[model samples]
Target chain A: MSTKSRKRMLPWFPGSGAFVDADTAVAAPDTLARVTEDQRLTNDGEVTVASPDTLARDTSEREFATEQWQEVIDRKLVDWGRNPQQLEYEELIPPTRFAIQSAAAIAMLCRDHALAPPMRVVPDGDGGIILERWKGSLSTSIEVARDGTVEVVVVEDCRVVSRQVLSLE
Target chain B: MTSGDGSEPIDKDEIVLRRIPATFEWYNPGLGKPIAWVAFKPNENDRSGISVWRRKYRPPCEVAARNAKPGRRYYVLGLRVALLRAIGITVEPSPLEGGPGHANLVNLSSDAYRRDKDGITQLAKIIAERLTICVDGPFGPFDIDARQE
Candidate 1:
């Protein structure tokens, strides 16, 4: 018998397709991206984890890793004289949820400006990826957008502090 | 005038009487080290002399005029004496010339203000008593006329 037929042939078993629903799976990609972004901020340019785990792993390891990354970002923010309290994670928003929101916000702003979609990529280290506008000649603020891209402005009068390619480990 | 010990009166240039503390150091070439000394500035115009307290094994001799830098020696002697007197030690004036003590007193008094850790009050008092300068206070006009060259 065929694989589907054999699965159906089992009397006590439910039908073959036992998978997560679309909304649950769709939410995961953005969640992973936010986690990735948070990791970037905390490592001080060091990339820690690759992809977010979808499985039920040890909670302790995850909590420790999150705390470490949060500390890194918190220190950087404090050093820059920015308040970390403003960046506190909301209960409804997963840490990675912000990445999707930011991306959408950027996209909306770019659309309003009649600009092309900016190339967005997660860089290796804690340093964030550069969102180059107008073919690298002009760059928008990392945490702020003057052109009304996003309301979540983490940086004001964004100035480029340093730029270099970080190695992925 | 002569003392009862038959020593002639210290001439204007012979007997040096610089008031100094009981202990100080003198540069001794024979021992290749600085020997403890004292100063004696006797007359107003006489050059002060420093007497090195030579070790018992070493030969005792008066430092020659040419070999001594009296101005520098007097200043040092004065400084040492001031420090000693601060702690209540009595210093005696020496009769010899051209030793470390004489140079110390002159050197110290001449530029006591410039030297670090030289107490102005103590220096003024020592200068007043030893050089016979009229010191009205720790800082005032005095008769001592040594100036930096």
Candidate 2:
């Protein structure tokens, strides 16, 4: 038989491409409209009221706090006999870990901000999570699969704000 | 025997396919290792008309070798060319001439036979696919060839 007459099969690559993107900008209509206009400025030499320090503080503070929360989450994951690196790569994090981390992060944020009980944790798919501090005011649901896949969704005023998959362990 | 009348018999041509059972073994003396054996059958209706060909298959080495199991049954099928050559039926060799004399063993590409010592490794793979068995293991570093008597 000719060499080309043999049977062949295709190769396999791991991990289906499933992910979420979260928007961090707090979208208050009037503030967002002003910010959009501010971004369109082209050095017109007009003094803007928006301070760079405030922007820096807002972004950096949350990032630093999230990192600190992640460290604690990492330790907990390791103690639970799950490799954090594998979980991150495989995108499979247990619901227990997700709930723990979410609750802990919210608790830490509340304590730092001196807020009261019943804080809401909303995870946006794009890597941003929101913590609302009102009773029955936020409608966010977390779905977890037995395989350790997590989906977080937020429904507010009949609008979906954050819908995302997160790795907790 | 007492009947004096002569009788005429009618003959009809019919195509018959033969199934011949065969076994192959590879022995490595330096390692004092146990011999690896594969069982297969040759098809009679091969057009190449050759016999005594080598077939390849993936061995369940990880599971079998670790357990020190012997006589593992691997699935395999005989190639028409190899079948014909195995049976002492000689035919014109393909343009590829790597065999001893006119016997043309399947020449698997170098990339395909990267770890294979000879084309027999590829043949084993073909047989395994036909038999629907998983075969993956280190058979040997020596070239396996079909020997006909």
Candidate 3:
């Protein structure tokens, strides 16, 4: 798609090029702008019929979240160069490509489940990533290991509420 | 003992250490695992304790530390600084900066891990004690019974 047309579509679809998958756009009407944008670019140039209500501004929140997450991945932890270790040691490990991919999946999961953005996105010392969210005294953390397993733990009032592991393999 | 500048020392005897949960609630790791410090005088109610936190560094959290390198040292330092700040030990530069005085506290913290085996643990103890003295709110330094760190 040309940049001009994409820019013109922004007001109606404030979240352009946000989702990589068109199927994701199908769930929310707010995404129709992007979906339409996609359809406009495709060879067929067609969108299957759907009720107008299902195509309204529903994914605004999700789009905003997707953008925020995208910003994190793009930086690739370069901003950490100013810290003490960066000064002393000379260099630090950047986030892995796999880690960024896992983050995207986790962000989509949060969107699908209506979960808020995490308070933190930590990269563990074990070649893994963590997403942490907090509400009052309640805290939830999801660990995405390089092995493709996800561990979710919810703590309330400093006590464990639930702990479960999901296999993404 | 007091420094020539007349400020009192950060007496180990004066600090009351407490054991709490392994993680800090107020810390936002996404903000680059920051190294920051805040200073305040309890009960003095003057302009001393109302200062904003001072950020020293913001190291990126690494994907893994299995292979310790020069870069990995940063992640450790950042966490130590965070832990120290969490427990109320100030890492901010002050008029007492430089020399072997109150400012040496910062120097000591910065160099301790490289100097001694028990350095990290000792620092954590100092921080825990300082935290016990300063943090009175519900947010904590809670879980105060662990005793070992």
Candidate 4:
């Protein structure tokens, strides 16, 4: 397909709906802008695909490319984190097999909880895995240690509101 | 400098330099995103304490050069010690041989590694939020082969 008029199935979900995968969960938590074939895509890239029921959005080249971009990036992450040496950095250790497994489990948990899929998922530098999400001034991290212990932390405006080990049973 | 046991304190206004690995969450594997939460995650070997350098003892470029290895380059970011402490995070000097500015960014709790790893990680994010890039460049650090760099 040509780069100009690429057909993209924008992962537009309803505001009250729970996300089933990281793909759609990456959208803003409670706010959603619906798009349809009849909606107009203006030259300025602002798609006024909103009514009282829909929200306004800028379907700029970058924003429209994000869904495809995120998929490619996620695959690239798997390739980059495949082994210890692939970790690239000298001091960085690879995420343990268990840590990687826990990350999957945690991602599933996020979907189950209707929470955003991790905005970023990478090695914890301690041979563990960390799944992170940033919502405005709040940041949440679910770090799994080498031993498979999960610590879910929520930090708001640089202050920690909760920090405790979570038993992923 | 020897290992500090908290008897001596790092001044609040002091700038500390942290070496960001290429795979850092915010760095985005050369994307070099400056999302602070991803800046100071504790190293596996360090329990839950993160390694940082007190810039008061050495310049940032010198610190970067000293820590740089052969194959890859390190990107350093500066954070205020006092800003970290304002959120109850500790910046303790634990100088090692040759690197007198070595320090550990420890959590306030005694049982940090097991119970308070989140606090350590949370503070790391805060540190990331307030971090300043030491090297000159945009987005990512300076690339050797780009823009005649």
Candidate 5:
């Protein structure tokens, strides 16, 4: 793949061996640079996952690690959904339903792309959820803000090489 | 020092000490040692202000008194005031009731990435890079609430 004119430039997964942001693409020119949100929009995660092109795959084996990650999200919803106050040290606010749902959708996005399973999926402590994936020095975090917006951040050895926000409304 | 705008000027020489979220701090094997990028994010509740303590006012060891818990342990990291200003942020002293060292790292520009999250995410990444932890501060997540995941 040549993705020069492709309309759907996926968010940078860093080492997905597929997508890289403009900055990282420079350090490693071999990697394909993704277009900006003005040119690339990944609107509905579910629809993106269910696209016809993604329909052909080995779903059974690939579902294990992702299913485990989903459990963490679901558990947070149960623990903090109703209370909305009894968080760690009784200090953090509960995550909104929109945020939890958005996190799940982001997981699906990663699963469909065959990225490594998330290392952590915790509340942002302000009525939102954060989904984090780690690959050696590179960490990709997708956060679902309280209002259902998704912000994707990729950090390599403490330097944030790419930043993008996707609207899930 | 005043920037002549009435708002207190945070000197570039000051050091900012901030409490790190337990779940957000980690020692990555690939990156070597601890410095979680998530630890530097501005809390949404703050609307943009991330609270910190000025080393000149309160010092690192004394800050724990403001936010100490019974048994939980957490990490605190430091970033220079100049490093933040270089990235277009301001760290002004903001005294709170019984906590005079309290200050906030806020956006100098009102637009400030329009809260699209690009500002915080990128800021946190650089903060993590320049983050420095003291030996006295807790390094691991041993005392976090059992309920936390």
Candidate 6:
């Protein structure tokens, strides 16, 4: 019986078609490319379980792996600022999920503007977020509060260009 | 932390150091490795330094720096420090510089990520062995001593 027919025969175990034979291999565009081009892919029992796409998927997750900046914003920015609240010491202000998201959003804006992203995203003393981009004596930053209010500051090569309050809401 | 004036040719010569929290997992960022680092003013208001990396820098560079205050406890990845210094970023000799006692004297920087418990434990032990911490009074730079256990 053909592999498809064999899989259909095993109706007792629903979704058993996921188990492809070892020798099975599909010679189409790799599965990952298919995923990138179209948000879905099918394992038609023809693609080998060890296809390049499968290998890529297994090696490194491609979920947030997009372009350089997006990948950095998604993977690095989100997790790098983890701080658990410390009521006892009053010194810890863990990066809130919202703050992390806001920082990344601002970084994405910088990328969209063809500007370099901030070198660091710091929490403001008053419960806000700051994205700092510094080169030499130049400093550019975007400050975001918990309420989604933003302040963008640009200092190019040491001259303060502009500091503006932006409203994303 | 020199805020340069526009006509001063924007000095690119200051060495900005990051105080790696003893347990911060800075190596976990999932993008291309950093090729260079940039300098930014330290937030004087951020007491914990936790917010310094509220989102973390997207570009690769050793962006970590010590706060102006001394004896403030922050962690550093030893690896990144050496790497930064190797590429000529002028990383401070001690991870906890000007902060408290022997914790600043010990080498806590490592190339590996902080998620490696074995690495952190080993480094912690090395730090603990060489320094005697005194938490009697309110913890600050004055609280720690060089007398090792």
Per-residue CA lDDT of candidate 2, range A69-138, in tens?
4553344323333532322211112224544455454345323432222222322111222232212323
Tens-digit lDDT track for model 6 on A76-111?
565444433420113333445566666677556434
User: Native contacts retained per candidate?
Assistant: 0.00, 0.00, 0.03, 0.59, 0.25, 0.00
**Predicted structure with the largest DockQ when compared to the true one:** 4
Per-model TM against the reference: 0.15, 0.21, 0.36, 0.60, 0.61, 0.32
Cα deviation in Å at residue B112, candidate 5?
3.8
**By lDDT: ranked, best first:** 5, 4, 3, 6, 2, 1
* Winner on TM-score (1 vs 2): 2
**Residue range A1-169, candidate 5, lDDT tens digits:** 2234223344444433334233222112222212110122232211112333333342432455457655654665455555554445433455677776776665554444444456666666566777676667777777778777777777776566666777543
Q: Which ten residues in a row have the lowest lDDT in candidate 2 chain A?
A: A10-19
Per-residue error (Å), model 3, residue A36: 20
Model no. 5, DockQ: 0.18
Highest lDDT, which number? 5
- Compared with the true structure, what per-residue lDDT tens digits does model 1 show for residues A57-125? 323444444454344334332322243232221111111333333434433333322222222222101
Model 1 DockQ reads: 0.01
Candidates' lDDT values, in order? 0.25, 0.28, 0.34, 0.53, 0.54, 0.33
Tell me how many clashing residue pairs each candidate has. 35, 21, 7, 4, 0, 23
iRMS per model, in Å, is: 37.6, 27.8, 15.4, 3.0, 3.8, 14.8
TM-score of chain B of each: 0.20, 0.20, 0.24, 0.67, 0.70, 0.21
Which of 3 and 5 is ahead in TM-score?
5
Q: Which stretches of candidate 1 lie over 4 Å from their true place?
A: A1-95, A123-130, A134-138, A144-169, B1-149
Which of the predicted structures, 2 or 6, would earn the higher lDDT when compared with the native? 6
Please list the residue runs of candidate 4 whose C-alpha ends up more than 4 Å from where it truly belongs after superposition.
A1-77, A88-90, A105-117, A148-152, A162-169, B1-13, B28-33, B106-111, B131-149
Expressed as tens digits, the lDDT of each residue in B43-145 for candidate 2 is 1222232222122111122112221213322212223443433433233432233221122222332233334322332243233223222223342221222
DockQ each = 0.01, 0.01, 0.05, 0.39, 0.18, 0.03
Error of 3 at B39 (Å): 21
